[model samples]
Target: MTDTNPIPARLAALKTMSGAELKKQWRALFDTEPPLFNRRYIETRLGYRIQELTHGGLKPETVRRLQDLGEQLDGGNIATRRIRTDLKPIIGTRLIREWQGTEHCVTVTRDGFEWQGRPYKSLSAIARTITGTRWNGWVFFGLKHHRRAA
Candidate 1:
């Protein structure tokens, strides 16, 4: 069956157009010189512009609601907010502990932990190997507590 949507038909034509042609269309839609020569970028922006012109842009209330949601997710305090992973010690941090009257040192790496010049999958493995028993790596290394109130 033949599709009757002009927007889809125009977008499909955009896929086959030359870079120069896409840039020209970009200028017409955006009223400015295109930023880059990427065909996909031009096609996507142009397609959105076409649809936006046909069916008006988002309402002001909708935009305000979206911005409020973004602020809440960002913790509402941008200066003090940090990415979740930043709470952990950085790579190359050294964790030292005494197990069975012997000192064990482990170095944090980007990929995994390194102990005594040997690579280990986790601190629990090194702890088990050192103590001859199962242990929670974080607790064994004092990175976490045995239990929390919550």
Candidate 2:
């Protein structure tokens, strides 16, 4: 019987073999049965489902299949993303702004930031007067609104 744990020389020989020869040897290794599945199948199916969802109108059956497969595939991450996207608007509404020569971070209320430094009232006001966009210098996560350190 061939050793199930291949030695380094055997592994090197297998690596050097041609594709057709490798196929033959691989089948011979498993008594002529091909490998059952691989990562390619999962990637291909995911791509196909994404394409269907994006290109097609997302039929109910397809949506169900996608959800089922997603549950099996994603370890609860899919549900989390859905929840996060839903909650994104509530996040980053307020932030703790800090600047140079500040001892502590300030809470940015409607009137302006409150701290031992230069203050700003609102993030939008700050963004408008300081930067161009409403989301400038703000690192926002889901609706929980973690005001990250800048």
Candidate 3:
């Protein structure tokens, strides 16, 4: 019998194809307009799509597990979360904030954080206690700052 697997040939061809060729193949394989990402992104996604079409996509349970893990990683907001593991301060670093003229301090700890001699799982909880309002932990702690539009 002839070589049974078509995946290897199809994937190998991608390395040699031009950007235009990849876009053309993308339409054929994906049945839609190609995304506006760079050529390398297109090639990588195309490679995965090829294998996915041949072997089927990820299992539902696996997809759920990934989402759960992402929730933990994204601090429960995966829909718009960016990679932020690098932003967490080192243990023992004190995060200080001033709310309504009172200086507040939160210490980074082995298990989440500490404020006012009590343990807190997130900066948001401490913020809510301090302000009585829900807030993004990172934003509350001043780890992320957004520029306002004028």
* Colliding pairs, model 2: 111-121, 112-120, 112-121, 113-120
Candidate with better lDDT, 1 vs 3: 3
**C-alpha RMSD by candidate, in order:** 15.1, 15.1, 6.8
Off by over 4 Å in 2: 1-6, 35-150
Per-residue lDDT of model 3, residues 24-95, tens digit only: 999999999999999889999999999999899999999999988877765675433653455678989999
The global C-alpha lDDT for each of the candidates, from Candidate 1 onward, is 0.81, 0.46, 0.87
- TM-score leaderboard ranking: 3, 1, 2
Give me candidate 2's TM-score against the actual structure: 0.21
- Candidate 3, residue 133: lDDT: 92
TM-score of each: 0.45, 0.21, 0.53
For candidate 2, the lDDT comes to 0.46
lDDT of 1 by residue, 1-150 (tens): 987779878878888988889888888988899996466767888888988998888999999999798677555755324434465458899999998788999998764589989997577888888889999887899988899688
Alpha-carbon shift of residue 56 in model 3 (angstroms):
0.9
Q: Model 1: what TM-score? A: 0.45
The runs of at least 3 residues in candidate 1 whose Cα sits more than 4 Å from the true structure, single-residue gaps closed, are 1-4, 74-150
**What overall lDDT, based on C-alpha atoms, would model 1 receive against the true structure?**
0.81
